[model samples]
Target: MYIPDIYKNENQEEIQNFIHENSFAILVNQTDGKLWATHIPLILDKNEAGKDILVGHVSKENPQAGSFSENAEVLAIFSGPHTYVSSSWYDHENVPTWNYLAAHIYGKVKVLNHDEAVGSLKKLVDKYEKKSKTPLRVEDLSKKTMMQACGIIAFEIEITSVEAVKKLSQNRDKKNYDNIISELENIGDLNSKQMADEMRKNK
Candidate 1:
């Protein structure tokens, strides 16, 4: 991820929160000299010592997972709010651009078997669904459902590196940033509102 200083997000906690908030991410790897990508929901596990680990699964039919080579690097892209910005929204004449937030996590790939996969499923459910809500009991699932889900392969990626970019009009002057926020607020798109809110927080 190429991030300018103004748009760089260096806070580890903030980056993890962003990934958790937008858990569905694009897993990218190389296969036979070709780049392969699969969209899946991933969870970041924070151990008691505060170490972060990546957990997720892909369908057995999805050949993307088969492409991972030992020591090969994989990238998971977690995308947040994004929207186009019109030059007209700026106080002065400027080229139009897009504002967005994204995180790129690089890790070493390791496939997990049935037992580990089951544990991964449990962790996923626990992370996303609130503990207070009635959780979906995997053991209670029918054999058909269990077999069907178990067929999907699961893996853990030990994140060796990570980067995040928060390009929410950070390069713009305060006046222009404020103008952009005002314009975004009136557009009524949820993404625009999110961008506006991000800009406001940075201000």
Candidate 2:
């Protein structure tokens, strides 16, 4: 992430919260002398040592499942809302730019055992199912279905570092910043509204 000083976000709580809100991430690794990426939803956990850990599963049929070892290093990218910022929103002349929030997490991958893998799957199911009008719990799955799910591979990533960015026009002057926010809010799309809210919070 090529983040300018103005856009750099060093707030740990904000970064973690962003990760939690955008848990669906892109997991990237190197395999067979080539780079591979997988899109998946990860659950964040904190260890007794207060270190961040990420848990997720990969389909057995996916070749990336075998791309990692016990201590292999990998990256997970968690991206929040983003939108285009028009130069016209600025009080003075400026070029168009983008405003967004994102976190790049680097970690060491640790493959989980069969029981742990099953637990990870259950946790994911429970998290998303709660939003349903009539929640369907993972435990409701039939024995055969559970058996079939065993084919998935589960792993944990022990977080090493985090690089986060919040490009919400912090580099602009107050008048321009306010203008940008107002324009974004008026646009009314989800991404634009999100950018506007972030700008207001940061301001």
Candidate 3:
């Protein structure tokens, strides 16, 4: 979250899009004087007051679930494509580094009631199931399936601040930047290809 001026992305719309694309987030909070973390898929949505909030759930068995409270602060991290950037790709001598995009969101946590949780679940299921051959829905689930929800705790976080960083070789000159993209594409891994594509967009 310590983003340099050159790498800091203050574009709220872009940051929101990135969060939606990389919705699987690392949720962190303090528990018993120690930090607790959970990796889960969270969706961005607005609360009844029309403010931005993130919705997600954790299993009741998860110790982190018990830590959620109305006033507790939590952090959610959304990570994007990234890969190693070898100095060999740069024309001038330099050390290897990694290029990536990430967003850190800080918010106040609040546990949601059953009805609100169901509403959130409906939205989550509808969004992800859109691309499926046979889209299923929360309303369509059987009683047994609904009972499974009892094992989890749904919550929402009112977003207080967000820090987005886009470190896509913005410091490199045109020649080195082009070469870096070329090298990444040539590497041909999924991460490399995606990073190459993002670098081009950043350029």
Higher-lDDT candidate of 2 and 3: 3
Top candidate, metric lDDT:
3
What TM-score fits each model? Answer: 0.90, 0.95, 0.97
Candidate 1 residues lying further than 4 Å off, grouped into runs, are 47-50, 69-71, 131-134
Give the alpha carbon lDDT tens digit for every residue of 26-129 in model 3: 99999766898899999999988999999999999988887776338999999999999999998889999999999999999889888888888999999899
Positional deviation of residue 192's Cα in model 3 after best superposition, in angstroms: 0.5
Worst 10 residues of 1 by lDDT: 63-72
How much does each candidate deviate from the true structure in C-alpha RMSD?
2.2, 1.5, 1.0
Q: Per-model C-alpha lDDT, please?
A: 0.85, 0.88, 0.92
lDDT of 1 by residue, 71-175 (tens): 368999999999999999876788999999999999987788898898888778777667656877666778788787667778888888999999888778888
* Candidate 2 global CA lDDT score: 0.88
- Candidate 2: regions farther than 4 A off: 48-50
Candidate 2 minimal-lDDT segment of 10 residues? 62-71
Measured by C-alpha RMSD in angstroms, how accurate is candidate 1?
2.2
If ranked by lDDT, best first, what sequence of candidates would result?
A: 3, 2, 1
Instruction: Give the candidate order by descending TM-score.
Output: 3, 2, 1
